[model samples]
Target chain A: MSLGCELSDLQLDALRELMNIGFGQAAAALSEVIDLRVILTVPKILVLKPEEVPAFIDAEVEMPSSFSMVEQFFFGHFEGTSFLLLPEEEGRKLASLFGAEAAPLPPELETGSLERETVVEIGNIIIGACVGKIAEILKDQVAFQAPRFIEAPVDRSSLERRLAGAKDLALVFKTVFHFERQDVFGFLFLVASEGSLEWMRAAVDEYLGSLA
Target chain B: MGFKVLIVDDSMVARLAIKGIVKDSVDSLAEASSGEAALDLLAGGREPDLVFLDLTMPGMGGIEALKAIRSGHPSVKVAVVTADIQARTLAEVRACGAYEVIRKPADRAAVLALVSRARGEGAAP
Candidate 1:
């Protein structure tokens, strides 16, 4: 079923600005964490049916091989699950940058343990900053669950499974963060649950009203 | 006479927000979505006393645009308004001749203060 909520051009523009601000904060936090220059693309916002989200991601993300992903759920008036996807090679490069000094891994760790831990830590920072900024600007509060590391190839069915409880529709905020000097980048997506539509619209309107 | 202003940002909402903040204070206000477009406007004979620019745009990002503005229109003051608040980025923009750097989710008072400065008036109360 559709969410039956259609946002106006102005509303969508407002949401896009919100995402830009959110991801901009995320990039800043990430730069501090990794000590690399972080640049982000112009963030995009779209309202889509829950089932269509996977295809949209596949088209936008363009991962050639297996990818590393971190999923974290945020709860509050503006609730959603945020996904951070990095190509396997790039993820490895990023993990390597952490080295023993930044995030010392146990000598007995498994093959991909360092990569997993690195992505989870990075995901926590990116998702926290993005969602936290958006929530704060919209005058709402949010809390996040621990991030889950996913090492599988991303497929339609698997992605759909990530949206299991998100009935009706979802608003996807997508952006790519480029790690300058390191040549590593990742796609960040925030899938707002259908339940957030009404509240989101009201919050956005209120935000615009303040600007007016 | 009120000073002319230009707002450069890819996001329409951001343009609107800044415009709303400085609209009453400025004599004329113009907006462009990218660095290239902002230059085009200036070349097209739209000169503003102050330009509010965003750093992370699609093409010809803010730093390049700032340098070009400094070269061609040395009198026009450019303020970098963006979410990329890294120390390096801030230092680079300042070195490139940005009149000021305003963080995104643009704060109203800060924006007004910049406009006031641009108008040769003191900080906004």
Candidate 2:
């Protein structure tokens, strides 16, 4: 249940502020992209062991057809990955919003056209904006891999395998984005190596110390 | 003396937004991506009348940068420009000798007032 993430009250508080800034910036960028008033909220943040995500997902989300995923890995000074997981049907809805070929019947939405582009690019904006803000705040040079989009049904075992890191701890952020009366629910799941977590803890401590 | 301003933030997005606000008022502008870079500029003899600081930068976050600038250049004024407007560090920034705190998504008018207050250009705090 616990992956030795002993972020204190102060650390958690600091993390909340940091995440707020990062997610807020991302949501603003998304609003511009979708051309709507987008409200982003982080309802929960859980620092958990790697195996816990599947169970958590199984309990929370009911639809099996809505699994769309993208994973971006960042390294250098810290080793970890962040995954954006949502429903494919919802993703198609997002694509449609961008004037692209979404799930059912759009003859004009071609593979290389705006629809497919939107399907791929949404991940880029959401993941890039969030990760970029976090990196900027931390002042760390994080090299990130291209986001790998997986269009498939939500599978527990496969997700666990993809995210498996024996010594790494996960920081699961429950984020919601609502635009024009439509709600898109997703998770920004970050798992960092134990060493990186310790380093991050010290770094946060230094940040607070500077504030004091 | 004319305004010499230093804008510190890792995001070029933020810096660009801040620059638009400061361009007319402060003719000579300086920029630092990290807190350390800002200090280095100050140490290297680029003395700005006001500094627009961001709180959550990676290298030298705004608070430490504020401490450094205030400690070394007590006369120089710093106004924090951050999205974390309600952060507890606001009090600390004031305590550590920052002149004012400005929220993020800064526009020209908002920044202008804060900058003016920082430099004693306007009466209101």
Winning model by lDDT: 1
Which portions of model 1 show Cα errors greater than 4 Å? A1-5, A61-65, A100-105, B123-125
lDDT tens digits, residue span A58-103, model 2: 7778866347677778785655887887766666667667663234
- Give the per-residue lDDT digits (tens) of candidate 1, residues B46-109: 8889999998788898889999998999999999999888887899899999999999978888
Q: Output the chain A TM-score of model 2.
A: 0.86
Considering every candidate listed, which one attains the maximal DockQ?
1
Question: How accurate locally is residue A125 in candidate 1, as Cα lDDT from 0 to 100?
Answer: 87
RMSDs, each prediction?
2.4, 12.7
Candidate 2 lDDT over residue span B7-111, tens digit each: 998765566667877787776888888889898899998899888888766656678889888889988888888764433345667888878777655656788
